[model samples]
Target: MTGVLTDGPASTRSPARFVAFGGAAAVLLTVVMVGSLDLHRLTTTAVGLRRTISEYALGPYRWVFDTAVVLLAAGSLAILAVLVRKGITRWASGGSLAFIAWSVGLTLVVVFPKHDWSVGPSMSGSIHRVASLVAFISLPIAALLLARPWLRDAVWGAHARRTFRFGLLSALSFTPILYAVLVNVLVGTSWWRVLPLGYIERLLVLVEVVSVLVVAVWAIAAAQPSYRRSNTSR
Candidate 1:
């Protein structure tokens, strides 16, 4: 995988851009797709935000959602590839692995849409929910681990630490939202919906996107242009 990180013989500016762009794309694609959907019918009338975005996988234009998730998965792996090429540190390796696992979970969610609660849980929906929950949990852990090595990189020192701090804050914001999601899932109760469900979930999604993006964009910005010239350094 590291071998293929190169684009032909040239380094190509910086491949780290892929991760940054991919993170931005993930959020954008979801928003655009959901905006295109008929929310009046998709979301509950009383609780407009009661529905999770995953529920849209069953919509008429589900192809949009599916394609977006698949792209995100590929993008995540691309991120790992860049990190490996940059010189994998112990922390980076673990971070890369965690992100890869998160990508796989998203892939499964694409394969199996969320369950139709109206009809109760089927095997596929059950798998989807569990996958989504696990994936959500792993991303923040990855962010924290990935930040460790970057803090020590002289070339990327201050910027890396700043980005890491932002990532951690964003990840922390996701905790309660995730808990609300779990409550809806486990208790099968409408209590979670009592709050601004749509707002809460959207906040979580935004934080997740922001967390990933800060690291990715920082990676892009921090990439050493003379990497090839300084082959003896690391």
Candidate 2:
């Protein structure tokens, strides 16, 4: 197995890469699992769960999710920053940095505190809808920016195409999930009961899981010196 960051003679994968990858994986997994729980049901359930595990679990969960979001944004930004400094795909790096900043700000200001189980006109219900859209959309944007060269010229061109396709799908999947979360928040209806809501939720979950995993693998591959050298040469 190759190092996570080193490509040719003098490259080494930073521990930060591993941390970022792990955080990304957690973010993806947590979104799927928690997202799958019927929001309306979970909200209603939080009423009771709060008395039991909600309070105990709330702080840790919030911290973990919040930290993961920040880490992901930061990680992506760091990669883009390096690329920009190195004069590789400066435009893409700039755009990725902007998106990462936006994502972090949105999460902190809009989504973090809302994760609380508090009742009465709280935004927690809609937070997932908003955050998921931002998270999924920003990721592919960064991925495209970071992986543009590899995507464009690799002999296995299908890899880049798949990455783009998955990114688009992940971004698009948020629509239904967002709608489902919104409907639950606004109307008190169960998203699962709807004809395709359950299926949509599952599909979104699958897409997120697979997308994150693919990106993690891609990140590792990209960090490889040989991979970078080949793409740059192409």
Candidate 3:
């Protein structure tokens, strides 16, 4: 199979590839820098703050995460768009872009604010709850779309199968990490909350960080036209 799938000669780059790689790289770097911050101390302090002020202060943090999420979604969409332009997988690529757009809206309006630890029964809270639920349900939908032959084959063939496989795995792994962050760290409503939610959150975050790095590397490698053409030919 390896011999049957030898890559082609190198060629010039596409602007879309550059956009995808640069965006992914920027996201990875931002995540690394943010991960280095003393979130433990920050979260602890925010948790202790009188809920109102904590809510206000968390806005900036939420914005930062929202920005990162937007960049990642854009980068991924750019990759898909490039593939589609090359006649790789029109439907799958389009669906993926739609999913990203939906997810971005949900992340900003719902999931992002939930990290506040201060928002209560307000307009924002309602929007957050609705959006979060939508986001959660959309995850499986996005996963299915991603796994579809058109999208998966295009990406996997163009970028190294191993790289594409890892990207899918990274997306899947987000399920567990998201669960931990939401049920354990964010809510803290159950006896399970008595357990060390902090540790779980951190561990999951580490996984997410690693996943983004893998994606960034894949994006960079996939930018080469030779890589794209080889995979598409197969």
Candidate 4:
């Protein structure tokens, strides 16, 4: 994998740019995912993000959602590969693992629906929950881990700082809402029906999307000899 992704020893910035652009495209498609759903029927405030995605996966147009996730996962893997090739140091390895874990979680979302968990504690549902947790946790961790190295690298310092801020904000954004959701879950309370989890989760998703784009920009900047030269020269 390393050899294939890092095969080019040329000083050109093509690879990083490609991965960066792909990441941007993936984020855009993810935004479109909301429009693809029947928002009126599925009221955002009540439904969980996982439940919505899972239900969509079972719907007649499941392929649309599934394909988007697959593309996003592919883009993530490509970004990780480039990160490894650059050998940015400081949690890069951990970040790579986090990337893979996130992709796995994405795949599991389609494979295991919400029923296995929401209907009752079934094996499939358990796996779905596990996948969702891993996906949610790993993405932020990867951003954090990668951020330090980017911050330390002189050429990428400013971009790294920005990426770190975006990542930290994204990670922290959902804490209060997540607390509310967990409290509801633990108490088996009916308040969750009105808690607006879907809306909160969507907001978190937006943060995450921004975080990804910010990181992609950092990666592109880091891969170059220097930002100005990469653009001005070959």
Give lDDT tens digits, candidate 2, residues 148-182: 55565534345455666776776687677567667
Candidate 1 Cα errors over 4 Å, as ranges? 1-47, 88-92, 177-196, 222-224, 228-234
lDDT of 3 at 184: 57
Question: Which residue runs of candidate 2 sit more than 4 Å off their true CA positions?
Answer: 1-61, 71-88, 91-106, 109-111, 115-118, 122-132, 140-150, 155-158, 178-206, 227-234
Positional deviation of residue 212's Cα in model 3 after best superposition, in angstroms: 5.4
Q: Return model 3's CA RMSD, one decimal.
A: 6.4
What lDDT tens digits, residue by residue, belong to model 3 across residues 149-230?
Answer: 4334534543344434544554565465456446755667552244444454344434434544443454455455665343
- Total clashes for model 2: 6
TM-score of each: 0.74, 0.52, 0.57, 0.75
Q: What lDDT is reached at residue 202 by model 1?
A: 64
Candidate 3 stretches with Cα past 4 Å from truth are 1-11, 38-63, 91-103, 110-112, 115-119, 133-144, 147-222, 227-234
Q: Per-prediction RMSD in angstroms?
A: 5.6, 7.4, 6.4, 6.4
TM-score of 3: 0.57
Cα lDDT tens digits, model 4, 161-221, are 8877877887897585577767777887653364665566666767876777776665665
